[model samples]
Target: MKSPSRTILIGGTLSAALTAPVVAAAAPATMDVTITIPQLKVAEYHRPYVAIWVEKAGTPPKTVAVWYDDDMQKNEGTKWLRDVRQWWRASGRTMKFPANGISGATRAPGAQKISFSRAQLGATAAGEYTLVIEAAREVGGRELLRIPFSWPAKAGAGGRAAGKTELGAVTIAFR
Candidate 1:
């Protein structure tokens, strides 16, 4: 037979162990996103600089990814990033370049798929949030698009938005 204190402790531990999975199951959901950058037929065509981020109500925007001209010298690419006006004003000014897992070289005009685990999003609490995508090009145009969705999104929930000039199609799905 166990001492009363030991028995109580074991019971409490067992209870916590059983509840662990339940708590994890209730954690924030993950997202899969695809950003399409359309190729334009222009003499001065330049790959557009793009930024993707998430914003929760009453919270500052958090960058998910940024695509820029990483080939430039002396981190010159970062200077053009601010052309993405909204993202620049929101979180770009203070951020260092090449943010791990959140910055990449510009992609060719096509579908670029990206996945965001709960941890990548900072695991926002159960609530509504907005996904914002902005695009700008040197000697070109600029555009911004936004998609709103709820947190802990139901399986198979997804959305897409289109841009007029600098950007193309933006799609997001939660799982």
Candidate 2:
């Protein structure tokens, strides 16, 4: 038979085991973004430069991704980032080109996906936030779409927005 002290120790260990999952379940959620670049019927089609970011009221926008021509000499690619006007004005100009972990090459005409953990997004506050995706192509039109969502996401929470020009259907899903 086990002593009283031994029984209490076993009970304590079982209690901690039971609570471990609950703590793990409460960890921050991840946000997955799917950007669709529609196939345009044009004589000269250039993959659009894209910027993805999140914005909250009275707070600076948090840029999640910037897709541009990183192959240019002397980082000349950054010069054209201004074409994505809204993002350039809001966050791009102030940032260094080829931002680590946030910069990548332009994508082809298809669905491109990027995922962000709650920490990567820097969205610590729990409230309403908007996901903004802006795309611009050389000699082509520019388009921007915004999808609103909440932090510490609700069950089955997500949003989608469709663009008519340089972009297609953009979606945001919380996991």
Candidate 2 — what's its lDDT? 0.81
Could you say which candidate leads in lDDT? Answer: 2
Q: Candidate 2: which stretches are off by over 4 Å?
A: 1-23, 26-28, 155-157
Candidate 2 clashing pairs, residues 3+ apart or interchain: none
What's the TM-score of every candidate structure? 0.82, 0.84
lDDT of 1 by residue, 65-106 (tens): 788987688989888888889999999987998775678888
Clashes of each: 0, 0
Q: Superposing all C-alpha atoms, what RMSD in Å does each candidate have to the true structure?
A: 10.8, 11.4
lDDT tens readout by residue for model 2, 13-75:
455457785643554356778889999899998899999988999998988889999989999
